[model samples]
Target chain A: MSVTSLDPVRSELLAELQQKVERIQSGPTAEPVATHPALSGLLQLRAGGVYGVDAASAALLLAAGPSLAGAWCGIVGVQDLGVEAAQTYGLQLERTIVVPEPRERWLEVVAALADVVDLVLVRPPGPVRQGEAARLAARLRKRGAVLVAWGEWPRCDARLTVAGTRWEGLEQGHGRLKARRVRLEVRRGAAPPRERELWLPAADLAVRPVEAEQVRRVEAVPDPVRVVS
Target chain B: MSVSPPLRTMTVWCPDWPVMAALEELRPDAPVAVLENNVVLACSPAARVDGVRRGMRRRDAQARCPELVLAPSRPDADARAFDAVLEAVEELSPGVAPLRPGLCALRVPTRFYGGEAEAAAVIAERIVSLGVWDVRLGVADGLFAAEQAARRAAPQDVVVVPTGGSGDFLADLPVEVLDDPELVSLLRRLGLSSLGAFARLPQSDVHTRFGTHGALLHRLASGGDPHPISRRQPPPELVAALALEPPLSLVEPIAFSLRTTAERFVADLAGHGLVCTAVRIEADVDGVVSSSRRWAHPRWFGTADLVDRVRWQLTAQPAHGPVEAVRLVPEVVEPLGDHADALFGPGADEQVERGVARVQSLVGHDGVVAPSVQGGRGPASRRALVTWGERADGVRPAARPWPGQVPAPAPATVYREPFPALVVGAEDQVVGVDGRGGISCPPARFRAQQGDPWQRVAAWAGPWPVDEQWWDEAAARRVARFQVVGVDGSAWLMVVENGQWWTEARYD
Candidate 1:
């Protein structure tokens, strides 16, 4: 063995230690799952990580990627998730299982679905406790599956929030809604929030990044503050 | 070996029996027509008298008979209804061959009923006693001549051709009795206008000119029996029933006790080279059915699946009192060979199904669902959720262009039930939609509930009219929709129907 190298007579011992450290860091990892084309540059979804989203649409968007890539997905505790929107967002409907209103046993349902499906999207009945999330996280790492939570969670690898939304095709009273643009804020561990402008849906029913100067840009100035003391 | 002649055959016919079976659902006097593919298959006598004929389009038939009620042709229902008639006829004859739903054939009795005419009359009287009118009977030397005679017999009457007189009996019948219009027209042009004339032609020439089908028809016209009627074997009694001694009320005890019966049920079906895919389980409490449900399997069911269906049914709707008996009736059974596993097995679907079955066991069956889209205008009506592990039946097709449907991008959050909301104008008057698609006032502020804080409207669009099922008064719906953006940059899909406003979905 080289003098500077850590390898010794028992090289297997170093390998064992390496595995333990990797397990502590993230337990285990599965193949990387595809993300929405619009978020490809902004986000890379890895197995064994739970992502939290403020809106139902964002959760649907996260699941759509893996689902469209021939992966099985399960939805728990979301009774009103529009399936048409999910399909339009690129999820394959035939592979999606929805457990609406899982009431008191939602965590168990998520755990069960985690073992079977590649992706599980659950809207917890209430705010999740830290220990429960850690337990679920261990299971996720062991099972090599991803969890997308639509509501409050104490432990998350990242959080996506819809900071602002703008409708483009509607006027005062006559025109029907045709397209939408949203300002998204992505927050990760101890980092400054990253802001991105994207089309939630374009006039042609496509979702992608908004192009520069295609339409007149509005300043989006904040309204005057009103306070009564 | 010599081929044996088919025994002197008798055919019994009940005219318009498909229409008769469908008429069970309507008033007895209502003229009904059963249609398949918009063509009248069979019509009641009342409709017939009004010029509603078979093979006519439904619109034409309805025009001919203004009060004719229409029903889609249900072959299974027709078969089920005719099963009773077959059994009634079977009681008089040991071996009966069913020709179709409305017709059957049997050997003309020589000993049991004494003579051919006596047997025909006895069978006719027996069927009429079952409340099925318009049954006619005919006896001849062969099945073909017998069927033709049955067609010629009047209602509640029987026609008997003298012994070995099948040819003379069918002589006067036209060549159209062959029932192939093309051959009938050719025969008519060839100067053979009746069965007697066609029967007089040389058999070898007819065979050379018209092929085997023509030769078979020539033999039939000559009253020579070549086709033999095969009698139907009665279906086996496969229902398994278990009586709970001392009447157990708890689901666990009932389930535990019924295991042997479930095993036996599966075993019996296997013994007959069949597998049940759909079974109806019934729990009887004090002689009354307390809980009954039909469970279906994507593939054929096994012992465990049968047991699970029994347990789930009992658990879902518990018996009010102790259950005295449990019965399992197979609804849809297929040949075992059709459902056998392939050499390579079913692959990934089997694994996924097992995993889903585990989830279903944990949360009970209906907790998991598969989502699909259906054709409708309203957000709630457009989406359909089917319980996992069950067939999606009777779902309205989604391919039709549903006018007035909410445009995409569809709302991500659709409320299962409309959440009540208040939409008001600048004057605080509640906004409403009139019948003619006019808004009483433009919506200015809205709140989810009465005590919740109101949010100012930023941008708004309006009044996509939806009027559904207008002809059905009780189920009719009239509504208008609006897309309103709140000051917080959130958007909502609000609906107004019957002077009330509700939030139906969120653009979130």
Candidate 2:
């Protein structure tokens, strides 16, 4: 078929394929994750599970850098990100430029950064109203910048849905080493919810997925194969 | 039936004039005394208690306080320092005039400045706020009357001499207010105990006895002559001092302080539409002070010149210790005319000045110099060294010429010290001649411990010879100077004949 003659069918199929690819890419598939050690330890805890939604949002922002290059990324409805996650990512501590206090002069600070900064990672001062968020997003878009609105983004183009999970067989002990298991649930781009089990070792963030077949093999092996070769 | 009016003018006097002496003795900070002849130079309220009045002799003042810290007056220093005070006051009024060294007269039109009392109070408050809390302010219709009123006013008080009431005010004032001791004694002999009694004397009779002096006193006593309040112009010259805390080390802070002081000093000159030809910076290290090697530049001074002089003074400061304070005083001021061309042409910028200043600051002031030509027979004899950025102004006779000196069209560049030269051959002969038939000298073949290489001679000129200053053996050198054009097309003045070839100058 000539390139121009295949337009209609091609367009339809390409749109469908794009949707499928995005769904699959955004889904809960086993993927290697890089995280600093301190954050990995906190995530291993059972009580008061770490907010997976905020973490996933931050990760998305980091990945979408070229699109959101010089934008005001307002993170709202999330005090946990402001206090811990942002610092863990080295965003708050590594800044060499002027760090203005975030209070009455937050808008002024934004104005001052209009010419200088690339990405402004801000946690909003108050609740995120839909109208205010929309206005801010419009302004950011007009400025050719992206807005990675975290927490309660009112009218976002992309969203990462998170479900809580707990680790099993992990206990706080006096020994230097500890091991634990975790379950993750993620849904994105209209994909069905998926679950995965992973092992988190002390002092490391290498998440090794525990396969069902491997579990069966362990059960079948029986006491090191009856102590035979 | 008519009613008599109350007294409109009242004088407030300090009963304890010697309190200033007491304050000086009791408190370490008190070096205060009343300045009477010149309006209250300074006074400690303590001096008032012992009646050690302003203008009193040192002996009389001591008798009163017994332990008075009697500081001999420094009117000039006080006036220079008071420029800062006057500048601060200039913000209030444009017509401020110095009535005396320590006293300034500010004229405020009563209509615009509320009333006389309000104006006086405002001025008094401003004076007190200047950390001079013991000022006695007086307001009157004219300068003389106001001054008299101010003198009679108590410390920290404001006395107002009402208009049209000068005659009544003087009625009770002692005849001693006449200012002349002879006139006072004469008036006392005439049984005139008060100015009111003195004014009753006929002017003709007063003039006959005291001549012009008596006539003047009679007119003043009667308030017939209007006190001429001529505006006292600002000083023709300016001097400023900066007191640094914790002393200073790095040149940057000292330069910063100097920048501020120089700005003020220049601004003061600019106020009079004048400029300074010479600026003297005196740096006080500990208690000892060292003045700068006086530098004369153009009328208008740049920040670099000021900084350079300050740096020079500071660096040259004896090892007495770090400087505790610095005083930049402009000693000579000349009328600024329309001369735009810089002393060093426009090509010179602040950076060059700053660099020169930095060098002078690091090394001694005499270490950095500009080339000056002197009258002499030899190449070195005609050269004199002068501090950078200063004009030589006049030609100085050359001390003496070196024997066998090279003639005129002297080398364009002369090194202060001769660098060791390489000899091509043992005797006056050329060796190792290249294909071009050029002789390679030392530095070309022979190298110094540290320096650039010398090139071979090309088209060399004759060795012009002259011997001079043989009388002073310590300051004499016999050199056979020759001008040689190098293979690289660079002309140099080389000396030979003593079996040693020294590269003296270069003309590239």
Candidate 3:
């Protein structure tokens, strides 16, 4: 498929803006969307802003807490998302909506989903124009819904990128993939960046702050680090 | 005030309602019979035309009409199908008293529509338009007489007895119409053939012979009302209403405007030391209630919970026009002391409750679900997902002893769809479990697919057999589950049923 295929569908943002422009009053003080209790202070997401996560694993880690807390999460345009892995990371599958393909109506689909879901995770079908991106942000603000982009997004409340990760449970080329420890770097809008180590896919369906001893043991393994890092 | 005369009633009756309800999907004129306890309880008009009648044996009815369709009698189905008819009649008049699945009665407003006959005609027109062609209407001085009058009316017709003619009208009817077959038989044996003959006997003599039951029957025979209709007081309007000038249709904006009203309503109830558990949300458009539904909360409703209910109602119900007003009425409430918050610190439960409520607003109601354990043989069947804030009443109880269910310490995550896998022996040949509850070989390795590298089994448990529904040929199943732990320490629940291997759940 061509990357620049265009469909003649009208932008929902354009249609919504054409009507009487009454500002929708957001409830409360726009508290950040909840993250895992272990990473509560490390990550925050406000409405109308795009948040970035490094890998699909990191995104799933970020999504689990809010989902279990009763927030609905939607995954769009990312076909290879491992839902089984996501469940192990603490996601409530029953409350999750997976639309692996949004096609050309990506913007409209995301906006309509924003009206219903608390968080939307999207890897855009293709490059998004600046104007269309702005309109999408506005809708998110009006709806008090957060957007977590897998790839690059223009304006974001905070951007999180995983620096490195190490997997456990595998020994001497045997055993299955079980859990992983990850070092994540958080960059908030112009604020000084910060870093934290966490168990991204905790085997017990919980993400926790990585212990110093465990980090050291994982770092001591030079052979697997070269292969994974 | 002067002594008021007994109120007259108008009854709408549908014959063989249960049979009709069961045969609703069939052709309207199809010949169908409803059987109860091996006897024909009711039959369609087409079946009746072919000599099938009530009280006949099922075999006799079928023999009389070879094309007769037998439908199992279901009172619940009849009641559900009759709801639409009741709603239609309620639109015309409000005092609808459901006598049974097939019959309902309401007050006769003789003065409003000029006379009893005209009111009955209007009601008949409304019901007929709803596709119930077998509807019959009857108007008389009392409910008992009105019901009898309705039975006398032909299909799609009405019967109206004059104001004081109930006694004369009921006089000639056979005692069989009393509906007590044994009493009718006894009266017939005693030489009382008609209601008029039974009514002529002294009331004291009847009481002496049959007690209150017989006296009540005698009163009905004489056209005296068996049960007097008592006036019912109107319910108090506890709803809080907010009128919108331009009327809002969008859920967010409407929800925004409703926040204050909902909060204030909650506050008012809280002030009275009460908390609402169920609330009725109503939206009006063009001066008529466009939508109204009662939503029940799992626990007491907070301000945010109330607002979420209003939004959920708006989104679920497609309104006819822009909403002109919204109202919230507390349907069920409890004392605040019973649900008082902790004084020292915020309760974890209260926090979770608030978070769930907030999330319910962000997502639709179906967007949030809570996992519950249920009794079943399979991993997926043992788990039940309940929508947040809904009662988990219908799920099977987990306390029942499941004969072959996997032992406790259930997997943390169960795959919604089991993953197909292949379990192979040391030779890499596919292993199998035979019909004699024997493993063909000791499995040593497994893989989800051919290209994927096989994982060696570190430890394994028995392939406990589960043979269910063996008596039901079509639904019978023979499966065995094995808990296999890979060298990596990741355990899986694998099932081998009918020579197919599938991964049911993953344990971490």
- What would the per-residue lDDT of candidate 1 be over residues A1-229, giving only the tens digit for each residue? 6587556645657655654564468734745778888887677788887888999778888898898788889999998988888887888889999899778888888987887688999999888988999899888887788999888998577798887778777667867677888877788754578867778777887788877665444346355222221
Q: Where is model 3 more than 4 Å wrong at Cα?
A: A1-30, A45-137, A143-229, B1-7, B13-83, B90-104, B108-129, B133-138, B143-373, B383-393, B399-429, B436-438, B441-464, B482-494, B501-508
Which candidate ranks first by DockQ, i.e. highest?
1
lDDT (10s digit) by residue, model 2, range B385-487: 4445544534455445433434333333355566766534324343232333233442222221134453443344434444446675666645455554433
lDDT of 1 at B422: 89
- For candidate 2 chain B, the 10 contiguous residues with the lowest summed lDDT are B7-16
CA lDDT scores, all candidates in order: 0.83, 0.48, 0.74
Q: For each candidate, report its DockQ versus the true two-chain complex.
A: 0.32, 0.01, 0.04
Candidate 2 CAPRI grade: incorrect
Instruction: Order the candidates by DockQ, highest first.
Output: 1, 3, 2
TM-score of each: 0.56, 0.32, 0.50
lDDT for residue B439 in candidate 3, whole number 0-100: 84
Please name the candidate that would achieve the greatest TM-score relative to the true structure.
1
Which predicted model would earn the best lDDT? 1
Q: What level of docking quality does candidate 1 show?
A: acceptable
Standalone chain B TM-score for every prediction: 0.62, 0.43, 0.59
Error of 3 at A139 (Å): 3.9
Tens digits of lDDT, candidate 3, B1-508:
8978768888999888887776778988899998877899999989999999999999899799988888877666578689889888888877787888889998987787898778888888898898887899998888888999999999878898877788899999999999999899999999999999999999999999999999999999999886765433343445788898898878889889888898888888887788887788899999999999988664578878988888888888868889999998898776776557645643434434444554445454554455546788877887666666655545778789988987544554466778788888878778888877778887788765445557776566657789999985768989988877665445677898889998887653
